[model samples]
Target: MMLGLKTLLLFGLGGQELLLIALIVLLLFGGAKIPELMRGMGKGVKSFKEGMKEVDEVKKDIENEVKKDEE
Candidate 1:
């Protein structure tokens, strides 16, 4: 699933604006913490994708059962 916040953020941001934001983040978090933050984000994304897949599977199973009952 697409992240709504990500889509909303940076929608009309230009290159200069992006650079400014990056610089601010670097100053706030420092260089060393950025990698750790990105790694954690990656794990979160992976978990979210897995959860979505399971939801899809359950939905399909429910639909199939309903179809079988109709026959």
Candidate 2:
């Protein structure tokens, strides 16, 4: 079943295209380092999201404080 599903997806790909992409990634980062690269990517994205959340909270608090000062 798994093999059948994978075959269906690969049916649309020509051999050399996949090979070219695989070679590029291999050259950029060796086989053993890809997982660590992906993990760091995930952490960077998470940190960016948290930073945005903190900025938004600070903006909201400032707006509330300004409103209180006006009243």
lDDT of 1 by residue, 5-60 (tens): 46646497666876898899899999999999889999998999999999999999
Top candidate by TM-score: 1
Alpha-carbon RMSD of each model: 3.7, 8.0
Query: Local distance difference test, per candidate?
Result: 0.86, 0.84
Report RMSD for candidate 1. Answer: 3.7
lDDT of 2 by residue, 1-71 (tens): 46644775678755676688678988999999989987998899789989999999999999999999999
How far out, in Å, is residue 69 in model 1? 0.9
Error of 1 at 31 (Å): 0.2
Q: Which stretches of candidate 1 lie over 4 Å from their true place?
A: 1-10
Best by lDDT: 1
| Candidate 2 lDDT for residue 6 | 78
